[model samples]
Target: MSEFLIVLLAGVASGALNAIGGGGTFVALPALVALGVPPVTANAVSRVALVPGSVASAWVYRREIKQVEGVATRDLTVVGVLGGSVGAGLLLALPASSFDAAVPWLIAFATVALACGPRLSRTLASSRGRAAVLSPRVLLAGQFLLGVYGGYFGGAVGILMMALWSVGTGLDAATGNPMRTAQVTAVYLSATVLFLTASNALSVPGHLTALLTGAVAGGFAGAHLGRRMPARLLQGVVLTTATAMTVLYFLRG
Candidate 1:
């Protein structure tokens, strides 16, 4: 019961944070692992469980979805789905030891990405009139790579996407957030399908259920709250959570 409560709280935080910015996995993944789920399996389960939450967040932003100037929404989603599939395949095919060895680094990378994304976005947003430096093809390729990373671990994927767009096209991260939520849903949706079919994510249904239930409520609420909530406040919360988790994971490793 205590474990269930922990997972539930984690899920609520995860879903809310994802809706607000993109660091939910930093909350959910560690909770699962701490509860005795293997790192890789925990990742798979988190991906599988968070799909609905992301979908809910996406639904809230549906009408507000904006397009990247150079990359078509459909095209970006296609690459994300494809890239996610490839990454999922790699996760399932690789041995657990490899994932174990990689988990700390993955978390660290995500923490760094989360820490820097907004700054990068702000820096580039200031110079917005410069012609987009990346062509559509290049942007699509970058999205694909990010999808791979998202599928494999999915910590700060939404922020990373915004960062990529900011770097390549000078899009303001805040301006691109609604679309980022939508793209994150696509990436998670694709990974969820793969994890459900090919991974042992369902081995522990109780924890997953708790997480899912909390996430659904949190996702819905967060989407609504996001309109009123300050972005910097949420980012600070997520950054702190991610930073602490990164340190803990490194120490444990």
Candidate 2:
């Protein structure tokens, strides 16, 4: 019962965090790993479990979704799917030991990305004279890289996306957020297809089910709360959680 509760709560937090910002994997992945799931499998399972929540959040933002000035929505979706599939394939192809060794570093990188993303974006925008818009080729290329990172580690990818747009196009985080959610959904949905088919992520059906259920509920609630909540407050909470988790993982190692 305690284990079930832990997984369920992690899912709730993960879903909420994803909706508010993007740090769900920092919670869900570690919780699953602590319960004895292998690192690679935990990653695959986390992506699978979070899909519903991501889709839910995306739906809430559907009407607000926008393309970058010169980039088409269809092109972004297609590149995202292809990049995510390739990343998922890479995860399955790599040795488990490699993933295990890389987990701490990955988490640390994500934490840094989350913490500095806003500032970095602002700096980039200022350096670009504050009115610069990215070329279509640049946006597409960046999104494809981000999609690979999202599928490979499944953490803070949305934050990274917003950062890219903020830097490249001077888009406010609030305005770009819905589009970020949609792209995240696309990346995770594509990755889920590979994980469900090729990975052993389904081995722990009970845990997965609990997480999926909680995530769906949390996603629904978060979408509503996000409108009224201060994004900085939510982002701070997630950053602290991610930082602590990253430290703990390093200490454990």
How much is the lDDT of residue 102 in candidate 2?
A: 67
Clashes of each: 0, 0
Model 2 misplacement above 4 A: 96-130, 231-253
Q: Which candidate tops lDDT?
A: 1
Candidate 1, residue 84: Cα displacement in angstroms equals 0.7
Residue 157 accuracy (lDDT) in model 1: 74
lDDT of 2 by residue, 107-139 (tens): 677667666655675676577765455677898
Query: Which pairs clash inside model 2?
Result: none
Taken over the whole model, the C-alpha lDDT of each candidate is 0.80, 0.79
Residue lDDT tens for model 1, 69-168: 7788999999999888877888788765665566567656656656675465456656664466668999999999889878877777777787677667
- Could you report the Cα RMSD, in angstroms, for every candidate shown? 3.1, 2.9
How does each model score on TM-score? 0.85, 0.84
